[model samples]
Target: MANLPTLGQRFRRGWNAFLDKKAYENFNIIGGGYSGPNYRTILSTNTEQSIISPILNRAAVDISMIPLRHSRVDENNIYKGTIDSGLNNCLSLTANIDQTAYSFMVDVAMSLFDEGIIAVVPVDTSISILDSSSFEILSLRTGKIIQWYPRHVLVRLYNDNTGQREDLTLLKSSIAIVENPLYSVMNEPNSTLKRLVAKLNLLDAIDNQSGSGKLDLIMQVPYAIRSEQKRELAEKRLAALETQLKDSKYGVAYADAT
Candidate 1:
């Protein structure tokens, strides 16, 4: 029993398991990806890791908060007075029955930033051709682009009234597609941000191991587990390591022989 942990040291170990409830409950699916296997890992990573979501959310909010107006610029493309237009009325008064300008823009901007593309489908409009003079929006919905076509595209638009996603195929004329603002950077197959997300996702998967049980790791104590002082120090170090592993965004702890 000399090499074994004393009773008090064993009791101290239980403190490390305090934050294990979530890990325990989600033992089967700690690091599982989102429903689709396509390009949504960045969004999933945003949920788990605290690296990118805040910036994206803040950008969306800031962009949505900006005042929008319909205006005619001068011949030199300089600032001109605002124009009274139906477009301005539709955008400012009501994006849809359930959303204001800010809410609608938040959804649009978030999708554009997170998924790189969003579809603005004209749910109800005055004209099919959308002629500048006659075009008027009665209602609109923001949607995630599911399929692309020359003349039409499929989208999954969330209905606020029903609280569910409604799939719709919109003709090219009835839908406007907005891509990410940083299209040049995000369009790359070898996107650095995507690579970082992949790495974080893999790390998250590894971290799931700790959710089920303790890591299959060992440490050779520098000296004998004899004196009370050494035992306490060793226990302190082990408890710290355990807490670090459990409490980290991804379960990783750094240590070296010191």
Candidate 2:
């Protein structure tokens, strides 16, 4: 009889598949939040650390992709579970840094989760059709399940003739759902959260810097194209000048004199 694969083997297999899939999107942009009424006053009066004291103990900007785990309590109130049980279904943005900063981030994430500000499930990227108002996703790794009901869905399209355009739609019925306080800070004009998101996105764009100290070649495409155009224009002008000189009567005289 053939033996089944070990738990470690299964985990390794799942992790490899997840890496191959590039399933995680930028959480900083997609993650919802709202600032409380006292946020403005806090910013004005508190220090940087104090500002994030509600969420974080230290100010560190690191990016992390964490898988969500499911846990349950028994009648005795003892929690028992396996991380692998939910490995397949969803991942969260735990923290930006390594294990050194993991605990801090996890604390913040859990606090946020308890407050019902944001769900700990992975961001759903595959739902292209809006036929149903809500849907459930199961993780292939852990066989965990997460239900999603999008309130607003935004899609952007680029057209050469028309430039870039956005289509924003309200997906759900007009029912009041408590929004995450972080979203308010995100939407506020000239807010720290907005600045942080911009910075994080910029960092995300250049996340894969090579050992040769080179950024993505897509960034250099515009300059390369411009250079090629200039070279072609210079060549055309030189060709025209040569043609003019050859076509003139003075051309023969000049050639003979030379």
Candidate 3:
């Protein structure tokens, strides 16, 4: 009989497959807000139009949009600082953007940056493509040249279809950049299996650690509430992980390995 793959091997396979399927060319958006709804719209639209579009040949574009929450200086400063602090550390700062919406644009951008999937940069209003073939972005703000060699580029308009004609110039001059084409995918919640596995993995990690260390780490989380509440939550999560680990169908392999 063929040997069954170990849990570690399965995890590695899953992780590698996820990365291979998720690879994307870099993208920079000219204008957009970073609100939760805005991020949802962008993600949904991109997934529908670019990632899964039949006409586009299922091309993946790694999108990085500048946040409208800060001014030019502030935006530049924030991005530069993030770059300096190292991408992995940016998760802590994302809570400052918005906790109520955990997966907002800023959070997604930070996650992408962490994965080295894309870069987030600030540009002034009078931005234009210098070379379509080479994918050069010229920032009138600082006369600096930003080069992006993505398979495609797209412009997201806030409102009004009248301005699309003028924006078409920006699209025509650029490689694959185009004004918003009205298209979308049917929104669906994540699969229960995926969500369960993610939660189980997270909780297991915490549970395996020493109690004091886990509590210290939980307390350091910016969005986490009071100490007692955090402790209770950790206990509950650990209990849940234990329960799932006991399940034969979902976690038997993992539990056996541990």
Candidate 4:
């Protein structure tokens, strides 16, 4: 089997391939939708620690795809899913970073299951489309399926004319959590419950880091596309975080943001 690659590595490879194929045009500047001359393949994996199989490595992915409609369908080739599915719909995708025996199937199922989600239009987040659904989440490039959640799905549609994915978050607001003070005290006094809380906090921290990294990537895409500025800023930020991770500074321990 092919070896696995980190998420960042996979992204780098995908973007590079996109550059080589001049796939930018496939992304319409005016028209909202993704056009395809063809498709491509790629792989991902965890590090070598589990090469012996004594350990298990689970790598989960989130996917998002732009949906196409009647006019969206290419004149040359056609898609097999819903004929009425519009170009604005997303196909969610996901999978373990490690290639498991059923990885592909599992990922596809998740995407298919999450095919439709109701949310405001991406173009105008303020305008609610009670009948419309969010784009099915899928692998950014491969269109693989991951897990699906309606609340989590944000409607992002491409403007056929502009080729830009529209954001509708402003049209509606993300749900806010109102934490109860007692909830925070449930695990107090250093008990197993506290330990669990600590673990959860750590997981949340990791997720936040991953999320910020993703945003950083998006912000730096212009530079990446040009292949001009070396990702020095990103690298520096990573180096700082690497030091913190080594020091076990992530998670919930250590007071005050370093």
Using TM-score as the measure, which candidate wins? 1
- What would the TM-scores of all predictions be? 0.50, 0.22, 0.18, 0.17
Compared to the true structure, candidate 3 yields what TM-score?
A: 0.18
Instruction: Give a tens-digit lDDT track for model 4, residues 177-237.
Output: 1122332332124465456556767898999998874435222322443443456655665
* Candidate 2: tens digits of C-alpha lDDT, residues 138-214: 22110011234456433221111222222333233411123346644422345665566577667867664534433
Candidate 2's TM-score: 0.22
Cα RMSD for candidate 3?
Answer: 26.6
Clashing pairs in 1: none
Cα RMSDs, all models: 22.4, 20.7, 26.6, 25.3
In terms of lDDT, the best-performing candidate is 1
Comparing 1 and 2 by TM-score, which wins? 1
What is the C-alpha local distance difference test score of each model? 0.71, 0.37, 0.34, 0.36
Name the regions of candidate 3 deviating beyond 4 angstroms.
1-152, 157-258
Ranking the candidates on TM-score from highest down gives 1, 2, 3, 4
